[model samples]
Target: MKYTEEQLASIRHPRGHSVTFAVAGSGKTQMLVGRVAWLLQQGVAAKHIRLLAFNRSARAQLQDRIRVALPMGAEMPRISTFNSLGHRLCELFEREQQLPRHELSTSEALLKKMARRALVDALAAGNEKGPVSAEMLDDFVAFIGLAKADIEPPDVVLRRLPAGNGRAFFCDAFVRFERNRQERRVRFYDDQVRDPVLLMRAEPATAQRVTNKFDVVIVDEFQDVSRVQLELLVILVGTRAQLNVVGDDSQCIYAWRGARPEFMGRRFDTCFPGATRYTLSRTFRFGHQVSLAAAHLIRHNRHRADTLCISAPSTPNTAISLVKAHNTGQQEAVVEAIAAWCRRNGARRQVAVLARLWAQLMALELALLEHAIPYYKPGPALFDLPELAGLLGYCRLAAGTLFAEPRAREVVRAMLTTPTLFLSANALDNLVEQILSAPEQAGRLIADAAPRKAPNWKREPFYLRAELWRAAQHAWTGKGAADALQVYAVQTGLRKALEGDATDATTEKRLAYETLLHLAQASRATVTEFVAHMDRLRASQRDYQAGSDEILLLTTIHQAKGLEWPCVVLTGLEAGAFPGKRAALEEERRLAYVAMTRGRSQLFLVIPPDAHFQANMEGRPPPLHGKPSVAVSPFLYEACLPASIELGAVLHQCRPEDVGAVRLPAAPASNQALLQRYLRAVASSAESSGAT
Candidate 1:
């Protein structure tokens, strides 16, 4: 647990204001823990220190490390994700503020529902430019999130947009949405994070409570902060409390939520005067080859801070190789390379297959299924799909009508939170409370809750109420469960909803309906038994996650951040695939840099035959095109891997039988078995291993 000199310099610096520029795999986490321990040694109270992580996963990791680093029976400093801290503060003062407690926690869909209502009001008031549909509201929602994150007012953002962007109507609606939120005390994820910044600026008393709560504030992943987050940090660091930010400017790849790398470097200096800067220059994660490749690619990005990081001395000088499939062999080549890696190295070494889009993973998924190679992907479970979950929800509600199964409040909450209905938080609570208040009148609640013709002023309430009633009636049929589901989908307009809702591809849309029908075939038993079977299937996924130690991580590049593996197979490296259509080239290069550095031992790049083929074709691809479809990524050239690199022999040569031959991971060892292994090793060393 010894710290490097570079890390020690930052941890032991005199407490005022400082920024630790930590590169990838530079062990900044341990340095953060060390800074806390140093504060304790400087006679600072643990209660006066606050550790803020950017996300829940980072918070959990920091908490685990704190326990390992600090002494037992010691008081720990307060640790929380930024939003969770906001949630805690809201919980404490909400009663006094007269906030809508249940409605405070919202979702993206419901937020758009709010925006959709605001847009309609704007249109009626003669404020909008032209007609707009629900499909186009994605931009409206995204604009609101980005504006809130940047602390930009509607007028300011409106001035920045082009004249003919077709989104001028949203500016007026934005103002109306804020008015609605402030009047009702309702907020979504972005609003929740910005609440503290707004509240502290508005009320001096609230600011005093927050400022007095901590003496020293340290933020992890500070490079990923939005403008509002930077403002919140400034408030906490207001001329008194010591503050430290630890992050890498080069690895700031999250531009979607208003994060740019320059904020951690130049912005740090501008915002906090005379803040000391420290850098962690040695990465112990990947070897020399990966370090060089990542450095080469990221330097192309115009916005990064100029800092040098070297590979560890103990790290190997591994060669980052390439795999080019001439035609229909992209999936087959990838699977072969993956299996070859597992065989050459130990199976226990983790390998990650990363891509730019989910569509890319679809092609790779078919390869795994063909070979029956077990892999893991952190995606939506089959039963958790909206259409599927709705059917289950109906079945559960239907079964409830037959018996007194949901006498408990939690069971009712479960039914209310299902995928089909997206109600305003306040309206949902009112329905649930009524059921609890009048247990005897529960049967009539769904049927009588919504009126025939809903009011025109507000949205979500009417639709939710009406849909719940109709769904309940349709599911309550005396027919079999599958037949009831079919009736429910038709009567409740679920099919129509899916068709119009934001489906990316027609194939995916058809897939959901096909899955619905397939699920219906299994719903032959009563609705209650079918629900239990679905629950059991979900439970088995957890066991499947623990199925093998040699698990293949199938995930997107965005999800692969803040994580590393021994071997990495990056697929779909074609021109239009990795750079994507909407992303800027510089930002795309940063993303590619992040993916390259995620390896410890090997980095294998794959150029599929064609981006169009992999995305458009779901099955075995046809022969290679005359000119070989789309070229390999321009970023691959940045890594010194050109599109015309010599084709390796075994890249497309591995047989499917060899892939299927690798065994599943063995079960864990028992106590006696472990003891015998230990005894055998000790006996060979000329010692009495164990008692006879």
Candidate 2:
């Protein structure tokens, strides 16, 4: 594909250390890919080109595009997410430095556990160091320490530290954590980014390896790069590393994840001294009306650069429209109504629902169930389900027993009494506690139980343990019997326990058995590994599902970054709904922005008709008190409402009766079969028409 003059200019220019600022829908990915291709064309070896993506999915996309664009025999450049890049860097640096592998690769929970252990060891040995304070604990718990993406310093930690012991505890833990990591010669995710920056500053050989070794370095999503990331990029490229960075400051929504959009505006000049700037003014996604709506909303943002304030040029699309519902129920009804409309309009397969919260999505699901509509959910809810949690835990346990540990026991106990098997929560918890407290007695009680009991084994602790042991044995042999063993464990009352006096010998025996089972499972499972896997799934499952065209997206606004759909409906847009009662922070602004921009051609923000029912019933003064203004977002008011109403639109007449019916259509003929028949008919008609 031939590049536009602008694209070529950005790629060809030899201006020192310049970065390209790319906006959403401006095709930053395509530009980055083009630059790589251009480098190869200019006699740069593919092996010497490196492409870095901030996230895994983006990395995969970059790799796919490279494969598609490169010649059949051409070598692929090194491509990786930032963490993966750090992993590579650590590996090479370790070989050079002759460092021992570190324990930082352990699960975050385990690492923390070890850190605490180190702290305890230091104190117990009369080291008089590393004391934790209440304030430091507050900070640690707030963000749960820094994410791999968060490269920010420990200022947050430092500020939260209490005097004396608290300060000492934090300092000790941090120092010990670093020492442990250094001793092992392994790098944590944070260390990967941090150490590279250090190496570039102190180690000339390492700096040369990253900088002089590569012919070109192309960075996408430059706006969200953390300070460490920027440092790594600077060291790798320097003034003459042939740098190409592309990002949109307006869309830099990852500040909480340690990204600094302001850095782009400040450092781009110094980093890429005398760099040329190119702007792509046209958007291919939104039509004139929708573009105007977006432009109107974005221009009001005080943080955006003046250049980004101008309206985007129109493209092939339709006007973005607003559909109002008065309350959450009514809003969901509208979502159903819109889904039905899409079916009627022949776009059912292309429709998606974007929500600002899981509760909103639950409202949508309830609406869909009410409408009897068949939809593939495309959000975070799937991974959150208890069943999914159980399955993933099992997978982790199976992947490596060393990772399974306490999780195996916890999940086993929970599954036995969960709704699937119907054991009471109290009964199950008592049994689990007993099993943990006295493993030997728990086993005997389970085996002695004559009743079949709950399939989850809530009745017989010993039986449950035995069953779990069997499952682990089956898993170890790589047999397909693990699921069956789980079923058996539940079926045999091994999952349940009978209610009795505290001193019941049968219960004691059952508890012992369960403990035995737990020990057996733990023998094969790694607590550290399981926790790590679970953590990964917890964070990424939503993103994994969102990319699928198969699942209907049902997610909160905060979850739907970098995703778009051909059809999108935002439901529950009432006073206490869309804006949410507590969304007073900038989170609300970003949530609305994320929800609005997810649409490709059609967008609907539904406000329920009975929005005032609660306030009216509560006898609280009406919203805006007596003025009774509709709670449409101020950002959306002007564009969605007519001009005669002036700047902020007022609540119009309530269309209480317009609460349209939500119908779940009868299952249609198989889409694949129908498509086949339609194609066959088209072919025959065309052939006959030619003869005629």
Top of the candidates by TM-score: 1
| TM-score per candidate, chains pooled | 0.66, 0.60
lDDT of 1 by residue, 323-370 (tens): 765212336777888898888886734888887655456545535654
Error of 1 at 690 (Å): 34
| lDDT per residue as tens, model 2, 188-300 | 55666666556656667667767766767878878778767777877777645677677766666665455655566766666666656775444445443444445444554
Model 1 spans > 4 angstroms off: 91-103, 107-109, 123-134, 155-164, 326-330, 381-550, 609-628, 641-692
Error of 1 at 624 (Å): 20
User: Where is model 2 poorest over a 10-residue stretch in terms of lDDT?
Assistant: 644-653
Clash count list over all predictions = 0, 59
